[model samples]
Target chain A: EDQVTQSPEALRLQEGESSSLNCSYTVSGLRGLFWYRQDPGKGPEFLFTLYSAGEEKEKERLKATLTKKESFLHITAPKPEDSATYLCAVQAYHSGGGADGLTFGKGTHLIIQP
Target chain B: GAGVSQTPSNKVTEKGKYVELRCDPISGHTALYWYRQSLGQGPEFLIYFQGTGAADDSGLPNDRFFAVRPEGSVSTLKIQRTERGDSAVYLCASSLDSNNEQFFGPGTRLTVL
Candidate 1:
């Protein structure tokens, strides 16, 4: 079965602290890996999409990197506003026009204390 | 451009009642998706619609949960005999295409009492 797991279910970091969140997956055929940031009572906001190993993407203070079996989201000098649940999802390649539904991890609840 | 939108930001209903959650995708988006997120858990896939057709409904939990996108832009998720277990946030997303990045809505919080 295809599954995605994120480590450090919860993390508390001080303002200006830099850290990384991990997402590991075991899927039949990996099509893409996605990163999202979700605030409480809101839907997830898209961050990045990594399609292959060694791929990297960045926006603002957040960066996402991908490997064969895992992906990492690195936050540089995170601020209190950046605090939210970071989610990782995978798209599996199937015979039926590529499955669009994403299998998401439980997500990492991040708190940046000021 | 405006992102996806969902109606009834919060819905509190009694068990055994029926409810409908609506989603309006971005203009020109051909693919729309529905997901459910329970407390402390990630969003789980529920259904996907490509244009006017439902490309995938395998993620739907059971027959009681149904979705429709008759016009390919606006969609509705209907639930019958709602149970307490059905209490969760219903999220709607849309993409230009099935394989592209999806834009999500604010989500509708459904609470079954």
Candidate 2:
């Protein structure tokens, strides 16, 4: 089975502080990796999609990088509004058995104190 | 344009009762998905529909769970003989195509006591 593991189950940071969250995965063949931010009782909001190793994407203070075995979400100078649970998911290259659903990690909860 | 939307934001029902959750996908999105999420966990895929046909239903836990997307616009998820273990937030998502990113709805929080 395809599996995804995220490190640092929870994190606390002060305003303007920087930190990085890790997501490791094992899939048969990688089609894409995705990052999403979710607030309490709400759906996950899309962040970035990294398709290959050495590729990086950024949005505001959030940056996402991909590697063969893992992905990293780097938060730079974060603010209180940035506090949310970050999720990582992977879609395999072939929809084996015709199941194209994504496999997601447990997610990392982030709290930013102003 | 509106994003994916789910009805009955919160549903509290007694055990063994049947419930139906609805999903309205974004305009022009042909691919739809259903997932269930428990507290402190990420969403787990339940099913996927392409247009009016269910391309994949492998994630459905059992035969008691069923979904339909008639006319290829709105979909409904039906659960029978609900058990306490079935309580969770049911999420609905949609993508432009199988290869696009899936955008999610707010989710329907279900509680079976």
DockQ scores for all the models shown?
0.84, 0.73
Q: Kindly list the per-residue Cα lDDT of model 1 for residues A54-90, writing each as its tens digit.
A: 9999999999999999999999999999999999999
Best by TM-score: 1
Model 1: runs farther than 4 Å from truth? Answer: none
Candidate 1's residue-wise lDDT over B1-113, tens digit each? 78899999999999999999999999999989999999999999999899999988989999999999998889999999999999999999998888898889999999999
lDDT of 2 by residue, B2-98 (tens): 9999999999999999999999999999999999999999999899898999988989999999999998989999999999999999999999987
Best by DockQ: 1
Cα RMSD, model 2: 1.2
Each candidate: chain B TM-score = 0.98, 0.98
**Model 1 in CAPRI terms: which quality?**
high
> Candidate 2: where are CA atoms >4 Å away?
A94-99
- Per model, state how many residue pairs clash: 0, 0
Q: Candidate 1 chain B: worst 10 consecutive residues by lDDT?
A: B94-103
Decoy 1 TM-score against native:
0.98
Model 1 lDDT at residue A97: 64
Model 2 chain B TM at 0.98
